[model samples]
Target: MLLLVSLFGCVAAVGAVGTHARLSPEAILPASAESVRAEAVLVSRFGAGEPHLMLLATTSGSVDGQRAATSGRDLTDRLAADPRTAWVRSYWPRHPAGLRTADRHRALILVRFRGDERASRAAGDDVVARYTGRAGPLRVSAAGTFAVLSESDRLSERGLHLAEIVAMPLVLLVLLWTFGSAVAALIPVAVGVLAVVSTTAFLRLLTEVTTVSAFALNITTALGFGLAVDYCLLLVSRFREELAREGSTGPAVRATLRTAGRAVAFSGAIVAVCLCTLFVLPLPLVRSIAYGGVAVVLASVAGVLLVVPALLVLLGERVNRLDVFVRLRPRKRTRSAEGAGAWYRLALWVTRRPAAVAVGVLLLLGLLAAPAALTRFGMYGDRLLPHFSPVARTSQEVRAAFAATVSDRPSVVLLGPGAARSAEAVDGFARRLSRVPGVRRVDTVTGAYRQGRRSALPPGPAERFTVGGATRLSVVPATGPAPQDGLTPEGSRLAARLRAVPAPVPVLVGGAGARLNDVEGVLADRLPPAVGFAASATFVLLLVFTRSLLIPVKALLLNALSLMATFGLLVAVFQEGWPAGVFFGPRGAGVTDVIAPLMFAVAFGLSMDYEMFLLSRIVEEHRRGASTPTAVATGLQHSGRLFTSAAVVFATVTASLALSDLLHLQVVGTGLAVAVLLDCTVIRALLVPALMQLVGRANWWLPGARTKDRGQERKTGRARTP
Candidate 1:
């Protein structure tokens, strides 16, 4: 309680001070256009121009029109003090509706730099120092698109809190329902709490080396709480069954330690491995997500193994009391009659009906996934904020006023030295860029130079055109904020166009477009490799664990089938033009993210946890030489309840994640929810044994004569050499 209070207090202080979280400049400021090739383009576009760059600060908010507008006078006075600051402006209106228009509160401060690059940067530093906190309480905040999004830090924070508030009770309900004891719930929840703290401390330290995203809190909390809960639930349920059978918590814990503990260890390792695959994408957001996920998984494992068990040892009977369901007492252990004869009945049924179930599941997912195909993609980052938000207003206005042409987008280009900074050089380069399609507008600082245009100069960074006497030009294409996935056709076109630039100057085009292009390129390039990694490794591990080549192969094939169905569904809802506002909630008519595939791949493997756990006992029984049908029946009987419970745990976490306003959250939440639902109901329970029965001995095949070396060499006792 003390710690919770302290943490909340800190969050409140930061929120009150208004800088606990801030948007990354990259996320907020528009990316350089797809057309830009040279940094000079950025330098020229708004750099040397009549100072289009401005910092409009208000020590006030929307609450009071009179008092906030009055700050404009104080702002004007401060502006008058600095000679280098010219045309410093602020739009403070006395009436609420007056300043509420698109243009209000966004002011431009025209700067006069005294010297060169060093001087200008120094001046910028001074500008920040002078203006940053000059105003008092209810102080000045930033106003550019990025600045506006930074302010939405509060909203994202609120989102995380909301997800937790809604998710926890449901999980507790599941725990209570599972254990029939209030005390048992603490084991998992406690472990999760510890995970949360340890991860926060680690992340807090990591913040010193590098910045953490605003989503860090949400990520850690979700994962920490999720893993703790799931791992604990898995272990606790097993431990309870052991206790009921043995009539002693000690023996129960030991059996659980040997059995469920082993399963937890295996699942934890896989989840960690799967989450680590996220790093394969090589993006900051992805890396952060990986870090957060790994921490959470570890925390969950730790909670289940170390903390929950330890607590169980400490307070065995007492833990049961907090549980409400126990008071009711069941006459006997709950078991469904249908599930009783399930293994043989299910096996025979499935061997009879695999195609029907497969078709049904595919058709269902196909219907859900149809929304993503015909979709277009765009991110209204801060626009997702409510109408009351100031940042939302700021973003709306800038986008409204700015040039809609692709050339006007903020972009950067890379070019070598010793190039011409003249109209002839620039026009030749412009013609080259102009020819390649997707090149909306190409403006060479050199062309601006020869034409004697200077208003665009300061903003344009024109003079930097000649690096070592060779000229470089920056191109700007007008576009909305670039896509995060970076693999879209737009990203592809930008890269192709940059290569197509016929510049004697030797140019490398990039900025927002190229950067995103690179991101998309890496994703496309690496996804295959990651899939190979997962497939080969899973096959090897499953083969060794199950000692059945056919089972492993079939397992992987089934997993792949489920994943494809998931992707199809993702494409349907996010990529195709479906009004996702119904289920996934509030999404526009567009396809989902490029990274969605990778995320699903990694997450699907994790989602496969229940399947692996449910099948392990059955497969082990099969290795002991039971008939496939008998083994399937026995395995489902023992594992079915846990499978149902685990799926519920996964779904709860997923639903919580879905509640986050971020699209990334929505993608993960949706994929996980659908995949888990399918894995539990359609894949694990029915598909495994059916497929196994169909293949029989082939399921345990080994290659070549070497197969004789792997399994018990069946003597000539069964049959003489044919």
Candidate 2:
């Protein structure tokens, strides 16, 4: 009753508080970064930079002509008339030729809203709901930064529902097949569902104290379902084993708790430690995922350890009732003991030629991991969506027609007080900025300069550049090939040059490119510390769990091998667009998303998860006085099936996520699925047994006080002095 009520409470709370979850791009950076500070200056001095909303107005005729111009004018005027907008600008009337498409049938309307990010998103959503679609001869659709973000949030919600609808039934069927009993199959699903609901409630509570990304929901569901099912499988399988031995529910539960429960606890702890390292990253998106990861792990642990065990105790022998798929396999094969199983035979075969097998597997992994050296990182824009999408089309249109417009969107340098105090100084700085390579133009309060020549200043607001006491220069990057993902080399180079130039006052370079550069910097700077801390935490956990110095180090090295191989495969398939016209398509960006590091974090944790399960069994066998080779083979036999099933289930869940229409989600799902599969098969099945054989007794060696004590015991056992 208590468990039932608690689950109900979680569901109820989720329904009540989930609405507060937000989608934000600002969540990617700190509010105090140089780019953020530049934005603050723009917002306070000029009503710019804060307006993230935009619209792409298209028509059948040339946007430069009078008809399309008039329609665009009317649309912009109407939008500007709204109380929410701080300002609105359109290319049709004043800058017709520059903003129109090459075919001349499309134009852009840039709109800025009043207030902070949340308020602006709300206003933008309202505007989009009200004004998008046909208007006069022009068709207006919501596009640009906020539009893409809003649409992504909508798709995330729908995709979560779709993943659940598709994954749940498939998981149930797989579990039924694995267990061969309807009653046993349903238990893990129940625990998974409970964990998901409970995690949603936890995220809702987290939102009250700090900003939680809507993106977190997707991760929460994935982690919750995958880990919950894994934990339940471990517990249920162990419970059945104990039941066979003890012949009663009570002793079986006790023994299962003692062995499998400890493994589950350590597994969860290791994964949790690995994920918690994300907190060391400076981005809110990573931190939010960390929050979600930790919450779901804890929830899954509770459901499996507390709820499933109690229910098992009540069900007793009936836990295996309602046999289904009974005749799917031969009884002898299905009910094989540890040493009699397929994995045991395979382990024995591999151990016979341990050195050769280990060397071959290592060579294969090395080749697979080689491509990761050429991996490029970048933020994914609308390129993640199909080119047919309105958001994606608008992005392409903007890149084509108005690539060099001196709007608030371009790379900018904000000069502090007295940097460009005089008109001559401002003009000289503008000329110097234009001379820099990769800079298409520089726009300042005085005039716009292209290729070191000042262009005629059109009549407009002079205060746009000169705000408060500081002067701003908008530096347009020369149009070029698209970046791999988030990297904008040209923009980054321009920003760097602008900063290096001598100035009378302090200068802060900012914009999309600079902001992305800062994001990359934050990751690079924090990576060493984050990795060190996570490794230390994982090592401590493994040391306590295995009580062997060499084993934990071997485990870490094995995880690294699998992870590097996974990364290499990802780079080849996703970044280089291998088998291009099929899996990724022509629209493939030919680069990995900036979020690939996050995938590595999650995959590494999952690798440790399987590692813990396999090692725990091997350590147990070794402690029981078995020789090293015998323990390795027996451990593989006992634990290989368990880890394999968990991997299949986990891979199934994550692969289902890959079926999402969203590209980033697809990357996440595929990356994790591939990592889990490799970890289970190549690493666990072949490499682990072979490597353990090669190491022999040294695999269980412990150093320091324990080693000295063991040495003394060995000496005292045979008294040659007597």
User: In model 1, what lDDT does residue 392 have?
Assistant: 53
Q: After superposition, how far is residue 326 of candidate 1 from its true place, in Å?
A: 3.9
The estimated TM-scores of all candidates read: 0.74, 0.91
lDDT for each residue of candidate 1 in 136-221, tens digit (9 for 90 to 100): 43354334433434454555567668877987788878878876677776666666666776666555555556545545455566
Residue-wise lDDT of candidate 2 within 460-578, one digit each (tens)? 56677786678888776665464211144444455557667776567777776667777777877998898889888899999988878877888889988998998888888777777
RMSD of 1: 8.2
lDDT of 1: 0.56
Model 2: per-residue Cα lDDT at residue 458: 20
Candidate 2 positional error at 465, Å:
2.1
